[model samples]
Target: MIKKDVLFNEFLIRNATPEDAVQMEYVQQQCYPTLDPTELLNRNHFINHIKVFPEGQIVLERDGVIVGSASTFRCNFPTQESTFLESSDNLWITNAHVPDGEWMYGIDMGILPEYRGLGLSKEMYTVRQEICKELGLKGQLIAGMTIGYGKMKEKMTIQEYCYALEIKKFTDPTVTPQKKAGFRWIKPLYNHINDPEAGFACVFMYYPVDDNYKLECKL
Candidate 1:
């Protein structure tokens, strides 16, 4: 458990390295306990991510412990539908990560359950936007989990659920926060992952660095 003073006094958000792989993996597991084992990234995956895009891997530390993390890579706007595995290069981020791509694709972000609601996610999103501006990229993109879907599946269809979210009929554990952080839903993706909680679906979202950028939505 983290001390109370540490939360208000100081917390460090810094670039992740190979050494942080184990801790990052632990946080990932904790954040998505229901995710399929194969869908979750491992320690080796984190190390590979750091090696491939060191600047895009970041971690939050409170009292020297990594309590949160965000992973990303450069990629162009998706012109076709893609699954989480395809978009993230099967979690290794080696094949699809482009050096000079137009968008900063967020692969994953996790803050320990006990450490959430502290504006940590918002801070991370801010950092990601700053990175976009610094690199002159268009903006950030993510296949956000619809974590509230499983419970609502018996009550409503996936499409209906998404519509409710759009109309603010209800809130989602994952998508709501991202929306509050300024992400806009581009579309809904089916079979995006193996999470039964999300009905194996996810929402494709984007946060443009500025208003002038437009999505070329070929779908």
Candidate 2:
């Protein structure tokens, strides 16, 4: 009679502490084979994150082992199109979280390869949405990774691909999931994730504090 999703019934989510940095780093290395620069931020970076904004760090666990992570920070999200994900990551590294800022910018989010399809990601995003309302924040600004574009680049322009996804003409492994979780595709971002195969492009997306769209991701 245990009440939980039969697939991920034992999994749980919680705030991250400085001590969890090592395991979080392990999740990153296993999830992102793209050698994302954030992978370089092991101990100090994670410690710095918790030190400055404890509420912004979180980890997903199953059977006492960390399998996924999402890192964020409060900031005055730039309206200019020039701002992107690198800035979000650097803001945390330099302790640049703007106190009382209105937006929670997602610095990173990833799940271990084996842990995918368990509804862990949308669940984690729901955590962020709850936090946003609790903190009186406006919404979330996510420079979503272009995980789908790497293969489609030869077939069409990056802009065209994102446009297709925006209108639901096509779905992406990375962006589609988030979009289904109530995030809207704003535009195709340039250089959001540092991957050459993807042409360093990603889609800029948003979720409001009052978003009513429910994800198919049942917990």
Candidate 3:
């Protein structure tokens, strides 16, 4: 069984605790340097996340230092469709977190810039999928930032960019990686966040629990 903590390539992946809030805040700052200051989750927000839904708050550590973290909350689909600010309850993640909600909605996931491209995110996504099965929930849902759109605005519109991503015509730094990690495009979310780097747009993606891809968990 892959207990609460799992070791992979010298990295420790486990559920996050309130104490990790400081490091999480730092990591988030480095990951989204261009994002608005008001939108970033502070230390208090991280503490609230763990308090509200410990199982959905995960972090990755290397050499006993946190380098990546992901935040999620439970909610029912269709009925819970709302922008990031609304769904995340302005980063508090309390009011919107339904204890018995049917799906896990991912609000944030970030890896320090220096730690990128190590395939660590796949581990995070796997854990979320595993969490779904463990809780008997539907699956995972997210509004992914179109991080590559800002540089490509002169080339195509956000809609065209997402369509291209779906057809594999091109890839986005953020959305493509999530798609590779097993999330399928559900739609595009304009003004989802105040992210200029993403052209202020995000892509709605979903990863169902019953998908064919097998989980690598030895448990």
Candidate 4:
């Protein structure tokens, strides 16, 4: 077993290996219970994706145990098909939607329940930003999701949730926590599904991996 203290002290960020597939699969199931099994990519899928683009998938280890994970792939507007149906035809839209040579990163970041409220999430972004800089990427784009858990039932609409939370967007708030980490709101897109409460809103956010951008942990 991995030592918890050692794991938490250092930022063990690196590409996801085939060995990490099983652990990452378990983490996703535990973190997103409501996600459809079909929608969740299996271990083999992660292995394939990493084999082609190792830098795209990232995992965090506390000592030697996996505690968090995130993945980023080269993409354009609409990010992913699940978030925007048009994303499936990326080849066609690439010429029109994307600039002459600009590129975006589709990101999915999650942390184990126990490790949350810490700066791990922000650190994950920091790693991603560094990769973006190394790759000479223009911007980091993401579609944020908002699922109303049992305790969050009252905040029904996106506007209502933002007002209550005092944040500008739903997925990652536009306030201290996210903004201080070097993120900014782009625009709100359509919802992923029909159900308002359970549906996920496609809010776009971007971070430029420029020298001015600083990645810091609040907690």
lDDT of each structure? 0.87, 0.74, 0.85, 0.57
TM-score of each: 0.93, 0.86, 0.91, 0.71
**Clash count, candidate 2:** 0
Model 2: worst 10 consecutive residues (lDDT sum): 1-10
Q: Candidate 2 lDDT, tens digit per residue, 1-219?
A: 111232446777788887789998888777767745743446567778878888878888888788888888887756466434356555353444787888788877888989798777998888888788889997787878778788877788878988788788978878889988878766677665667555678777778886674223211
Tens-digit lDDT track for model 3 on 1-219? 222444446887788988999999999999998888989998899999999999999999988899999999998775534677887999898998999998899989999988888777877898889988999988998899999888887888888998888788877888888988999777787788888899888988788898874333211
Task: Give the C-alpha lDDT of model 3.
Answer: 0.85
- Candidate 3 stretches with Cα past 4 Å from truth are 1-8, 212-219
Q: Model 1: clashing residue pairs?
A: none
Q: Which parts of model 1 are misplaced by more than 4 Å?
A: 1-9
What tens digits encode model 1's per-residue C-alpha lDDT throughout 1-219? 111223466787788889999999999999999999988988999999999998889888887899989999999887799888888889999988999999999989999999888878888888788888888999999989999998887888778889999999999988999999989888888888899988888888899999776776735
Q: Name the 10 consecutive residues with the lowest summed lDDT in model 4.
A: 88-97
Better of 2 and 4 by lDDT: 2
lDDT for residue 72 in candidate 3, whole number 0-100: 94
lDDT per residue (tens digit) for residues 6-102 in model 4: 2346757777888998888777767666655544545765665566557667888876888877755665444334443334122122322333234
Q: How far is candidate 4 from the true structure (C-alpha RMSD, Å)?
A: 7.1
List clashing residue pairs in candidate 2: none
Question: After TM-score superposition, what is the CA distance of residue 112 in candidate 4 from its true location, in Å?
Answer: 0.7
